[model samples]
Each structure stands twice: as structure tokens, then as C-alpha cells.
Target: MLILTLVIVQLPQILRQVQEWRYPRCYAAEVEGWAAAYDLDPLLIYSFIHTESSFDPEAESSVGARGLMQMTEETFYWIKSKIAPDEALNFDSLYDPDCSIRFGAYYLKLCLERYGGDIATAAAAYHSGWGTVDALLENGQYTRDGTILAEFPYTQMAHYVQKILERYQCYTELYGS
Candidate 1:
């Protein structure tokens, strides 16, 4: 009975540790620094990384998104043009943690700013595209206003946004301020 009681008492801590392992803060310096620079929450960035590649810096998607943040060549080049116009770099740089996190954070900053700080809309735009999300917003079916998304148009994208939101919530509950 005493052993069972002790096990019960330790269960919550054990569960929390397991969850922490699942939602790791892998690139702390890069994540925190770039997040801070972009005026974003580190947990949000961590959630993105968790959902994108499970913190795997070498992860690649079937659609050719590469690295921790899973950026595509098109997005990488666009971001590179915006942030490092003169630097001679290629899409492969997205495989580097520093480059991936920095570029990902900048992209998040742009999405958040475009959506007027609405994380859901920004996440949708991230999974889909800003143009697609903008059309959804303009149709008056997904959003009542142009800012908050009432419903996601695509089911897959809805799930993606939901996963990101869920991870963000978990990350907050586990390691938030």
C-alpha cells in the first residue's frame, strides 16, 4: 500500500518530465535570441519547432521543407533577400540551427505583424500561405473581421494550426512565465 501511494504521488512529476522531453527547448540560445529580436514568445517558436520537425535539425518534409523550422527553398530565398541580401547563401543554410531559427523567427514576425498579432491567423498563414490566408480572410467566411480567423478554410491547415496551438499551450503550461 505504501509503495502504491508513493507511485501515485510521483506520477505527476514523471508525466511532466515525459512531456518536457517531448516538447524540448533544443536550441535555447538561438530560439530565445531570435524570438526576442522578433518580439515573439520563445514558447511559440519552440512550439513551431516541435510541430515542424520535432526539434530535428535535419528533418525534411515530403514537400521539401528542410531543417528544424522546415522552410522551403522559396521561403528561404525570400527571407534571405529580405534579411541578408548581400550574403551569398543558399537554401541549404536552412539546415543550420542558427540560420533556421533566425529565419523562422523572422518569418513568424512577418506573419504575426500581417495578422495584427493573431497567433492563429499567423499560424495558418505559416502552414498555408499569406496570399491564401488573405483570400480566406477577405471572403468573410473564415473571419468576421480581417484580423481574427473564425474558421480555417482547409481541414488539413486547420489541424496544423490546431497542433501548433496545442503545442504552444503545452509548452506554456510546462515552461511558461
Candidate 2:
């Protein structure tokens, strides 16, 4: 009876530990360094990574997105031009956790800045593209204001945003001060 009572009392904490293990912060140094440099939340970037690749550095999507943050070749080159203009880096470098975290955090910062710090809209832009999010913003049915999304124009993108936000919340709760 005492063992059963103790187990019941410890259930919540045990479950939380399991969740924390599930969302492991695999590349902590890279994540922290890039996130700090970009002035973005580390947990938010972690959530983005979790949603994109589940922390698998070599993960790839059917659409050809690759690495931790799952950037397509086009997006990688665009970011590369801005951040590593002089480097002779290739698309395969996205598999390097350090490079991926830097570029991903930088892109997240750009998206956040573009959407006036609205995570939902920035996440939508990350999942789709800034152009698509901008067009959706122009439709009254999608956004109540010019900067924030009231309703995601596409169901798939909406779910992506939800997953990002949900993981962000979980990461914050587990590790935040």
C-alpha cells in the first residue's frame, strides 16, 4: 500500500522526466551559441529542430529539405549567401549540426523579425515560405491584422505551426527558469 501511494505521488514527475528525455537537447552548444548570436529563444529553435527533424542531424524530407532544420537547397543557398558568402560550403554541410543550427537560428530570427515577433506567422513562413505567408496575410479570412495570422490558409502548415508551438511550450516548461 505504501509503495502504491508513493508511485501515485511520483507519477507526474516521472512522466515529465520521460517527456524531457523524448525531447532531448542533442546539440546544446551549437543551439545555444547560434540562438544567442541571433537573439532568438533557444527553446524556440529547439522546437523548430524537433518539429523539422526530431534532432536527427542527417534527416531529409521528400521535398529535398536536409539536416537538422531541414532546409531545401534553395533556402540553404539563400541563407548561405547572407551568412557565409566567402565560404565554399555545399548543400551537404547542412548535415553538420553547427552549421545547421547557425543557419536555422538566423533564418528563424529573420522570420520572427518579418512577422513582428509573431511565432505562429514566423513558423508558417518557416514551414511554407515567407512569400506564401505574406500572400495569406493579405487575405482577410486568414489574418485579422496585417502581421498576425488569424487562421492558417493551409491545413498542413497550420498543423506544423501547432507542433512548433506545442513543443516550444513543452521545452519552456521543462527547462525554463
Candidate 3:
């Protein structure tokens, strides 16, 4: 009875943390579709989405990234031109499950191509921008293995990398690779 009480007491925090770390079902389904469409692992897609927005469809970053996939305005516009030119897309559309996931998957496909199918490098590029990744590589600050040393300048990028990794582990455990 004491153990049960203790467990119940800790449940909310645990659940909250899990909520912050996992994608919701609607977002997961969209991610799965995108992964299938692009030949990406669904677990990887989930990890990215989990890290980006914690499955919040209305999420918007300070840098103007929006929705479950946290896509930037420019990328959204580019995707709109290529995929949905006749359809109108605004910040609200970014909160729509299908549009956000499609754009996110498309960007991931682009990154995978750019980074030669290296997930870590591609993810880093996605978070830090390709230019930053390129400059870091050019200056020998990052390696092909995706190892960035402790002295790396961008703490946000580093944290982003770590969060994705952690979320990926959770995704694998929850859904398997």
C-alpha cells in the first residue's frame, strides 16, 4: 500500500515528462505517412517531431518555425510552391497535421540527401542550418561521426542534438526500430 501510494504520487511528473518526450497519435500517424512516403524510418521521424514540438500542432518557435515539425516560414513557402501551389497556406496551415508532416518529411529528405544519409549529421544540419554545419566541418569543429566537442559554440544546437538522441531512444523503445 505504501509503495502504491508512492508510485501514484510520482505518476503525474512521470507522465508529464513522457508527454514532453513523445509524439501524440495524430502527429505520429502523419509522421508515419511521411516516413513511408520518403523512405525514412518512422522512429527517426518521430524523434525529430518529438524534439521539435513535442507533438504540439500549435507550437511555434521564436525563429518562426511552426507546428508538429517546426518548419520555418521560408521552407513552408518553398514546399507550398512545389507541392500545393494552388492551395493557400498560412501559419494556420502549419498547424494542420498533413501539411506540417509533408513539409517536414520533404525537408528531412533534402537533408538526408545533403548529408549522404547520415542521420546525425542530417539532424544537426536541420537544427543548426547547413551553413553552420558546413562551417563547423570546414573549421574541423565537427566530425563525420557527428561528434562535436565540449567547446562547441552553439549550446542550443548541442542541446537540440542531445534531445533528439534521447527522444530517439524513447521512440525506439516505444515503437521499435
Residue 55 shift from truth in candidate 2, angstroms? 0.6
In candidate 3, the residue pairs with backbone N, CA or C atoms under 3 Å apart (3 or more residues apart, or in different chains) clash, namely: none
In angstroms, the error of model 2 at 104 is 0.8
Candidate 2 TM-score, C-alpha based: 0.95
Query: In model 2, which regions exceed 4 Å deviation?
Result: none
The better-scoring model by TM-score among 1 and 3 is 1
Q: Is candidate 2 or candidate 3 better by TM-score?
A: 2
- Per-candidate RMSD vs. true structure? 1.2, 1.3, 4.4
Worst 10 residues of 2 by lDDT: 145-154
lDDT for each candidate structure = 0.92, 0.92, 0.77
State the lDDT at 82 in candidate 3: 79
In candidate 1, what are the lDDT values of residues 1-177, reduced to their tens digit? Answer: 999999999999999999989889999999999988888899999999999999889999999999899999999999999999998778888889999999999999999999999899999999998999988988887888877788997898999999999999999999974
Model 3 Cα lDDT, one tens digit per residue, 1-177 = 999999999998888678654444456677778899988888887788778887778899999899888988887887788778888777578888788888888888888888777676677878877888777766655564443322346788777878877877776766568
| Candidate 1 RMSD to the real structure | 1.2
Q: For candidate 2, lDDT tens digit of each residue in 12-70?
A: 99998899898888899999999889998899999999999999999999999999999
